[model samples]
Target: MTSGSEFPFSPDPVLSGTSDDRQHALQLNPQQLLDRIPVTIWQANDQGQIISLSARWQLITGRAPVDSLGEEFWNSVLLEDRDLSLQQWINACQQQRPFVLHLHLCSIRGNSCPFLIQSEPLLNDTDQLIGWVGTLQSTDVVIPLQSKWDYTQKFLQALLDNLSNGIVACDTQGVLTLFNSSAKKLHGLPLCPIPADEWASYYHLYQADGTTPLPQAEIPLYRALQGESVHNAEIVVKPSQGKPRTILASGDPIIAQDGQKLGAVVAIQDITLRKQAELELRKSEERWQLALQGTGDGLFDWNIVTNEVFMSPQLKQTLGYADHEVDNNFEGWRQLVHPDDLGEVAAAIEAHLRQSMPLYVAEYRMRCKDGSYKWNLARGQTKWDDNGQPIRMIGSHQDITRRKQAEMELARLNRDLEARVTSRTTQLEVAKNQKEALVVKEQEARRQSEVDRAGIKLYESIISNIQLGILVWHSQNLESVDHLELVSTNPAAESILKMNLHVEIGRQMSDIFPSFVGKHPDILLSLVEIIRTQQPRSIENVPYTFPEGDENLFSLRAFPLPEDCVGVAFENVTCKETNEPAFS
Candidate 1:
């Protein structure tokens, strides 16, 4: 045989396409690549004689390549001592199968080294065995590669052991292959090599109650091993050295592509704290229910974001509503507010929600289920989120209709007393005027000057003390433009119009009530007409808005006075009109 025998094998390819293979190739040629690796590639004929060997074989054995051709190649590398590995190789060749053997090779320098020889029979296109091809790897190269793999496995194991959740994995035979640190902490014991039947007892597994022992079939890991996917299987662990812990377990079976069950894995989470919190919440709810029953005040809890409200039974009853009468929402609650009081209630609630007020409080009226309205004293506080947005509100309602009725009655009595006092005062003033007139009549025959002084004093007293606002306007025609100039005003007129008549005495009447010109031109026109015709005219319920935005309704009577003047008398009637109940 020659060193370069023409064999049927093709030249080794330069690795391509894949990143890993290209990285390993390092741009070396086929012969150079074979020599760089820590193995010798060889080819043999059907008769078990070496036909060709790679250039690395001489480097590995430190011998001449041509001298080791044919049967001498095997004899040169194989130890003089016959081994079972050689016999196994012979048997594999006869059976035309693959084999792996461990043997010792001696170099020309008398150095001995252990090596692994793996060989597979080469088949022709027709599936007939043609020859054999194999690799001989030195133990120095094999050992380091094996150590690399072992380090990688240890790194993965440590990573799993440091996780917070417990992990457990088993092989197809139910042998516990992996039980991490969290699992040991939960079980209070190291991994037990017991069979599946005794796993529950060995690991002290129990039902979710923590008292009853769990059966092997009910164990989450065992069920997963049987090709079942278990999720949220709550179990209790009663360790010998620790308190019982509740765990939520989820697991799944590991299956191969061909549907073979390879193993199973399970993850466990501790839920003891969550369970305790749930129990406390249940107890707290019971106490809250008791408190609601003891206090008869109507309670309302509102979620501002969702606009949903929880109306307690007392709240519904206070409004004369059944369970299904009112919708449980913010809009429904707003719809029941009395229209006259809605603005006040809304402002109070908004102030509290914006944190401008410590708490919301407003007295308003709410329409009842029976189509009547009742006074309600509502007080609430808002809860704000971290961003200072109102999230929730809780409030109580108190029925104050009786108290409001009492207040109204007391107010009406006060008005009545005031009216009676005014009527009596008017009668006294009339009697005093009559007495003064009689005195004037009687004294006119004796002292004319004294009668004149008495008459002037009477006129001034009536003008200053009367509640009706009185204004004297002198009609003027300046440059053919008609206007009224205010000449005089009583104290009542100054207070009612919120102006200082002394400062405004000579100002035009149009300037004094400028706001009324556009909206109520009839008031000014009537005053001019009364002056022109010298006839009395009356205007009732004339709406007037002041410069400062205060609004009122006034009933006015304008009559012609002497010297081109008009006398106007007006009284505020806003309250009387507003207090009258509506018919529809």
Candidate 2:
């Protein structure tokens, strides 16, 4: 089944063409001839183990021939095509026939290029398989005759499809002639037959702002078709199905040799990631600027090695100087500081840089342009070189004049308060002694008042609990019985009288005790005498009978009271001996 003319050439050398050709051709060695050829020739034993490869293999694939020898050549084939290609080669070897394949070959540069491979098995005189030989030619190579145009077109299409950048082309009439694979993927759609006016909308094209639609004339391909060369114009593509992407376009008008306009082509690169990074960096810088402004602090950077200083505009404005008025150097800044604070400021900086202190901080009074001094807080950190020598320092300066003034005023007030307190000490002592004496007098008066109240309460208690029946009688003039009324009585009086006197409190005493008028008419006379003379009188065992039809004898005593009233006390004397004289 072996073919006669496909690879494994049998006797094709030429020596009869011309004297120069014969000499040159004869001088060429086998390796030299192989290297000069456009195609790579390779050989494998009957078992498909690669045995040899020509140097042209390295030139085209960026791989060494030695690395591809033996079975390792199969590893260089792309994974997607290796299995099919190897199976076809195996079938050809078993049938002892010629083989052909169009497959992709992977290069060390990480690109896959299409190639045409053809092989034929070498047989012994007895038709036993010995080895196989093949020729590898890139698909882009031009074949000799009729199929050349067709192959060229296929080769160009393949090349365009493999590119990472999107490509678009249009004819002179503004009709799109080519939209490569990458272009379709980037725009999320394929070619449309619309006119140039609708190209932007059809392809989802936008301006660099990503919101405004791109004008038809401003489209890169459209401008290029109008004979304009567009370079690095940023465009946005918002696909309906995915996230928007940013692309940079460059294109030129295609002009013929005779200056005739043929067409236009544009190449676009996706720059979405780069643009996003730049946007984030810009926002971060804006935030940093806002922070510096919010804190009202100015920036400073000093090059310790070069003795150069840089101060921010805010710092210069705080000092009442124009941007260029102040010299930017350590000595210039030192002159602005108060003469007394320069030593401590320099010491702080030295300690941080030389002694490896964590921070450099100094508070001092600085003189402004108007010859006024203001307090300032300066803080910084140092950057060191590989040898640990301080090379630079960067920091901020804040105005603390108001805070420093407040502190000084508070200190002065505290001193004045101490002196005033010392002066008032004698007066306070005299007032304390006087107040103590007054407190002692008040305490004695309060104790005496408490004793008087206790004695009054005791006397009333004795009066209320006395067993003698006592009654208080009141009169307006002691003139008539209708004019006097019984006022009050005690519990003991009610018990002795054998009646509830509380209910009879408002009755006239004559109505209460009829004995005053009838039983012993002397009792009435004695009562009248007692009322006229405010003297107390007593009666002894005067047999008194009466109003409830019982006879009883009781000793009675009457005492005149203030308020035209009299208090009468009586005892039940019915059990006493009547023969003895009751009064002594």
Candidate 3:
């Protein structure tokens, strides 16, 4: 019509714009418009294949537009949400409405990039769906940053809650930022927020010497804030209700990315048991050294695995070796032992090892460098590992040569003395037996003599009652008349005897009977002859007269006694004036 300049509907009708203007107002170049938008925009067909994408979509995916325009573009969605994003886009196109989905999208580098996608249907003038258009914006950092921060905070709190050792952190302004359960207990305070000014009242740190508060430079946590790590620093914390307690503290600094100091983390441990053990060990070593010195004994430690021996200085001196001269090995020790004692020494050691008992003790000779052997008394004990296997041995050695020599000499002297005593005792016993035998013989002889004397007295008494004069004389010496006395006489002889017969014990017969000595010399001779012959003799019908009486007839009888003695008896006969011999 414009070309023809002819139109039935003309400007007279309510027409203000031309048809070209109307067509221009209703048309848009989707690609060019999408490229101008800030959000990522895309169009997909009913089959969910990408038809077009904005320049921003290519920039975020780092892909060319041609490579990204396909159903495969949905592969860029995270595997966990790909199907859901596709289904949502399809439903929105069918329903002819806008739909929103939150999905993780992957780029060309396979990194997850979160996005919020809002999709709406594109329709034709007949209201039939053509495709879907969508816009995507990255919400990776914004959507979950707060939740992540909250989770991190809770995890840190749990860690602090479960810690056993005290933990504390402070800011550069000396403000308490974090305190753990253990820290509250250590400081003897409730788990309430502490003002900065009151921090010193709850937690007081002291130097190891305990004489004064720790200088700021030496405090572990303070040092840590200055970018230093402290380990095993002693500290003392004064509690509100109790005395101060000792602790070992360690700390390190927490730094930010810009190397700025954030705060410090500190840990404390109680070391009272360790300190007491150290003190006790020192005392034990001192006592051991003193005891070894006092006893003049040397200590030795031996390691079985290494075959090495450690000897005290006293041992070197005792062995007559310089302090460093003696070797510390089994062979070295064996070489120093005397040849004669080596067997016994080795046996003792073998027995100890085999038995796994407490100790082994023995005395043996050890060769000195000067070619002399000295006796040594050694005692050793085996030490075992936890599994009951021997690992080491410790022992003592002492010089006993002088003592041993003295003991040997004393033993020899004792043996000699004992032998001498035994010999003397035997000799004395023999002499005693001989003396006793002699005494017994003497007693027997005395007993026999007593019996003979008793018999002689009885015989003399019997002969004297025979009314005769009796005499006894020694056989070997008849004249000596060892025992002769008047026994009895008739009334005539009692008057003629002229001597007191009762009192004449050792008197000779001649002295007591002197009248017979002259007139009866023959009778005395006969008595002597009978004693010498050990025979009986008699004289009968012999005439005799007394000096003061009438004439009388006398008869004599004599007999030899046993063991050289003689007995004699005499009888007197007189008539009564008629021719009758007197028989009285």
Candidate 4:
């Protein structure tokens, strides 16, 4: 028995045994040994004829070892590599050395198996090659490599065909190697005779700002070729005759398995819409500024969380503060508010925030730099977030100090005028009451005079006993003289004078009759005569008439009473003639 280590070559136990045993193993052949070795092995002669094959080769090729022995073996080789393989085998046989080959072997299952073959020339002692001994190893592990290669080719073709964005692949030298369908479509070119590095210059791509052509240094593809990965790099490209195009580009370095840089893959997408939107936003901001300038109201915006205030220039001017003097914060406003009005101002702001309504009016005193406080009418509205929390406030402030002062002055004037009117009304009311009292007193005094005059006439009638009328007069020159009451008398005056004789007896003449001069001219002359002579006088057959239209003949005698009142007694001459005619 020979151990494997004792043999220089691993010899088959059956082959090395005695002649009888060898003959027995030769009948079994290398085909049986190959199948037992778990690998398929075969040998072909110098003329590309199969000399022998293991059982696995027969099983894989679906042919017997004897059937594979001649030109039939060459026919069994895959047709694509058969001719080349045959030449290589002949060369190795001529050199009388070992050679290696990789070939696709067809299997009965219609699948192909890859194998590595190592062959050594079999030589006699005379140095002449007799046959070849080859060993075959199954290469099933290489199946994955072939599968990956097929999938990569399909994946790249699909990627280039279906991509929406422009894709270009270039070698490290900037020579265009691959251009996708989108890249062709973007430049309005066909895929035939795809453009190379000349495309870079022929397109004449410039930046959107019209500054310059896209420099290789700034291009994502160029950066990737320089061994850098670029992501979302923005670039603008302008053609020679059209509007500029904005693109967001990305690139990555393509490297071989051995870390050798091959080229770069670049992806570019149009971004013109995004840039246009940004430009519109800037214009909108400008319009907002213009609007604020047009309106006269002082505008302000305040952030609640930050407590910062943004005021337009007009707002600062309205507050009587220099632009720099007004601090851009709520604290500045709070400090400027009059101490007395601070609470009210705070309440108004809080109410607006809580109610989420516009505060149309709030009046407060704002201290100016000159140390004077002016009234300001502030109106504000709270801006709310989606959750109804107050986030910002916008408002206007108006200076109303002049108007407020005018209103206050008007109120004061009104109060003063009301007081004056009340005072004048009191004086007028007192004067009116006093005048009424004087008029009442005058009426009563006149009534008393009539009573006194009647009394005087009655006294004269009783004492004289002569159906006489008495007329009393006031002495004009004497301030203390009694005045007359009787304005006129007739024959019927005797009875009327008798009624008030007692009351008129010793009264002052002017006291008894205040209107004597206005009533009679004759009585006034009689009173003057009596007062001048200081004597009694009589008049006979004087005609007198009463206010009632009755006539009488009277003898008048006038005498002075106390206080210079005249007592005038008139006797009816008709009765006197009747009574004293016989005696005459």
Candidate 5:
């Protein structure tokens, strides 16, 4: 009972009138069965104080039942859950109905465990309320639920019963903990507890030959702990309690989510009878030859110590050879092996003999009886002595000409693909150069347009700045006079000369200048003199007549430029004439 609990049990359900009050008594041995029960059972007096508890309380709660008597049991409850458990208990009692809640039990060792607390009120024969019966079952309610772990445990148990192989498991500390029935039978007895390092000694396991002591590093269980899956590894176990047994063991590592090595599981199978049958079968050469025939393979056995080799009849038959046609020496094989495959095949065998490889396996060509070659895949396993030296070797050959031919075809296609890529790349380069040439042509044309624009601007500036009339003339003849031709003239030249030759830029000098019906010959004479002498000539007060019959006084001059071209400058200086003398 809680020391300060306030609620009372309701009397309605506690009476013997309802099905809730139905009760029956059965005989139970408290000392024999109750203590062994996996849950904690308790009884509380009518006053709601705990009177008794099962022994499991001590194991799970880490406390003696006596230490949790009466309301002190509420002290064992965690402080946060005590009041709620008390209230739940009182309410269930008052209502006379069973109640279930979860409680955290604090152990004497300062650890806590969760429990499913259930309670039902007990009554007397007089229909009077009695003490309460309650149970505390350890629960996961207070901690995170491990649904996956529970599933794994159930799955592992299921597999143990169904699998044929004897399985043994160990905890992380290397202590053997689980031994399935199969394991017990295969091992002849349960393995006594031993350190992980002493397993080989305690178990007495040997190599497949039954005499060589099995190395700890070669043990399946130890290799599993190192995170490997060892399969079909044969060994012999000669136990002190049983006859010698040969077994095949496979093992795997049980690792955690964080890659922690949790444990190892090893499966053992008894192969003693099977191994004996295999040995008996090996004695009949006819059966061996028949087996090789069924598999369509040829066999060869080599004795390294004696330098002797035995080739099966099927081997000679495969090469289209009759019995006794080929030599019985290893040199026969070397001569038949294709030259291209000789070095590689030799290297493969040497690598296995030197222990660099686990098995000797190679695909190569061997010359046939018809002088053609056939591809064959050869595989062998060696029997080694204690010092890892090969004593005997046995192998088989399988025809693989189709596979090798397919590989050659694939290589041919790869070469064709490379050729196509190279051709495509060259074509792209040629197109790229053509596009670059077009770009160069476009740039040159744009530069020419810029130069033309600059020349036009310069010409306009010189014409607008010069004040005197300027006429450009070129000689039309080389050895004659009066052959002056007008090539160009400015607006000043046309206006001052009163020629009004706005639309006559390329007219000849004879058409633009006043010639007075061929009487004004001085103008032509001056041009001829300038061209012949390549010098300047000036004429003052020159008489000039217009085509309208009006006379004008003008000062005229002609200057020679290079390339038989002349420039003329003339002005109407009638008002400014001061009788300056002119010379030509």
Candidate 6:
């Protein structure tokens, strides 16, 4: 009957509310809670219009809420798979059930970021299907083609498409064929059938250094046509349409059973991030060399083939050794390191030599001349010969003892704060249990005791379990309190005054907490004013005086409780405290 009627669950919600539906309008403050959720949430109406979406969608996708609406949001899905994805959504809508699928969402950089979408239909009070809500989570799972035309082709294409590396094959004449999705993405070519050599100019193929333009014959595809098996041929593929990507390519000829020429195939692995890191290290080394006249860093170079090492004067100075005192070689540096860290440092260098890692980096304790250990960070870069053999290595060392000590200090402080929070959490739990117990005890006490006794018992129950110094104040007919009497006080509140709750209660606010009186004192009046405004207010790190003449720091908050009563919570804080407590 309608566009999405084929699926009863995917309903276009008619945005209308009844006069009798006032409860739905005031149901909850959804945004205050929803924004805190980790997942990317979205809501779409039955008519396929986006009603609402989470702020995180903009943060992750870089697409503003106003710009990404309805089908436009899904339009970024790979064109070949969009129709199938649409049908899947329709099925989920018809069933009115949750749907989960692995798909790619286009990012701001115009690259596909694979993610998992889990969505469910949203309904109203009368079981009316209104819309849908869903979350997007980044997933590593590759969404394979669901509809394979034939068993063999479907299986073959799905296998190729899901691979992390690009795969491309060509006929002996170099006619392009067997180009998988990864290959297409890496090359940034159109989906239309075409030959790589013909499109090579348009793709802007570059040499490994990312500056020299590669000739058509020198490109990986053409080199493969020459029957050459290339390995680790670093080619920077700078597509005119997409971001530049550096790929390590390997290709071998496809030989027939009869040894006849049968085109070739190449596997391309994107190593852009790795290449960028290496480039950065090289640049940093140059900067370090130029600044050697000013910085405190030490420099060293090692010729791997000759086993010869050269150290700068600063290098020896760093270890408190006179220049030229320490000999060159592994032994020169090894003896200066902590015995336990020496083995790991040697292993790190050896691993780098094996090409198991891009660079050698380690932080370890080195023995200073004073016999104390100091933390030092070392980073090494290797130079490889044309034949792929390591020829030389050079790097730098920097003293990082202060940084290490600060890290340990921060960790200790975090542990202390966590312990304090844990203690406060236990107190809150006890208070909650006391409230539940009092509700039951008060019901039974109502029969035996007077109303005043029942009320006092309830007030005392709250005061006993609370960790914060809490002061309860009564309101007068002025919509404010002319009576400055302290109606109730927790043990904590009374302790702040160097007295007991029985002594503090029924006394004037000025007589109990000195900070609430005198010339600048609206601290109590502010609390009363905040209650009148129906809003909570807090002031931090203010001075409070006790009856014992002790001045301490306290952060205070006042909020309206049930009835016309206002409750003020006093949080004792130290000058060293940094975080401000939230008021609700």
Clashes of each: 0, 0, 4, 22, 6, 3
Tens-place lDDT digits, model 6, residues 1-584: 11222222332222246854445445534453344456676777865455566667776678776566777777766665565455556545666766665556777777777677888777789988888777776664333542342477788999999998999886555555577889889988843334545646666778887889888777777788789988888888888787899998899888999998777888999999887887897876544443353334677888788877767678778778876787787667778889999889989988998899999999899887788988877888999987989988988776667656655555554565566665677665555565455555545444333453444345445444766787777665435444566776677876665666786677766666545477336576776776578677788777766666677787777776544567778877855446656333
Candidate 3 lDDT over residue span 128-196, tens digit each: 777776778888545669568568989998898798888887655434556788777776765333433
Quick one: best TM-score, which candidate?
1
Taking the tens digit of each residue's C-alpha lDDT, what string does model 5 give over 1-584?
A: 21223223321222234454333112223242455556777777787777777778877767777778887788888887676566556545665656676667887578776678888888778868787877787676334575665688789878896778888877555556567778777777774545467778878889989999899899888888777899989999998887899999899999889987667989999988888866884755433442342234677888787767777777778888775887776887788899988999999999999989999999999888898888887889998988988988888776666556655655554565566665677665555564455455545544543454454345445445655677767887846655666766778887877776556666666676535427766567667778889778787777677667777787777777555777777777767646664323
What TM-score against the true fold does each predicted structure earn? 0.41, 0.33, 0.35, 0.34, 0.29, 0.32
Better of 3 and 6 by TM-score: 3
Q: What is the C-alpha lDDT profile of model 1 across 473-546, one tens digit per residue?
A: 88786222247888877889888888788788888866776667767766777777776787887777778887
Tens-digit lDDT string for candidate 2 (1-584): 01111234433445457888868877875566666667888887878777778778888777787787776777878887776566555544665667666677997578887788888888888998888888899876644452676688899999998999999987555656678899999999986544577788888899999999999989999999888999999999999999999999999999999997777999999999999978996775543442343234566778898898878767888989886988899887888899999889889988999956889889998888899999887888898877999988888787767656655654554565466667777665564564455455445544554564455455445554667777877776666544456887788888877888999998876677765555565665566567779888888876756457788777888776556776778877788756453333
| Full ranking by TM-score | 1, 3, 4, 2, 6, 5
In order, the Cα lDDT scores of the candidates are 0.75, 0.75, 0.65, 0.63, 0.71, 0.69
Q: Candidate 4 local accuracy as lDDT?
A: 0.63
When sorted by lDDT, best at the front, the candidate numbers are 2, 1, 5, 6, 3, 4
Preferred candidate (lDDT higher): 1 or 6: 1
lDDT score of model 5? 0.71
Off by over 4 Å in 4: 1-169, 173-204, 228-233, 238-244, 250-259, 265-270, 287-293, 300-310, 324-397, 400-584
| Colliding residue pairs in candidate 3 | 468-570, 469-570, 470-568, 574-582
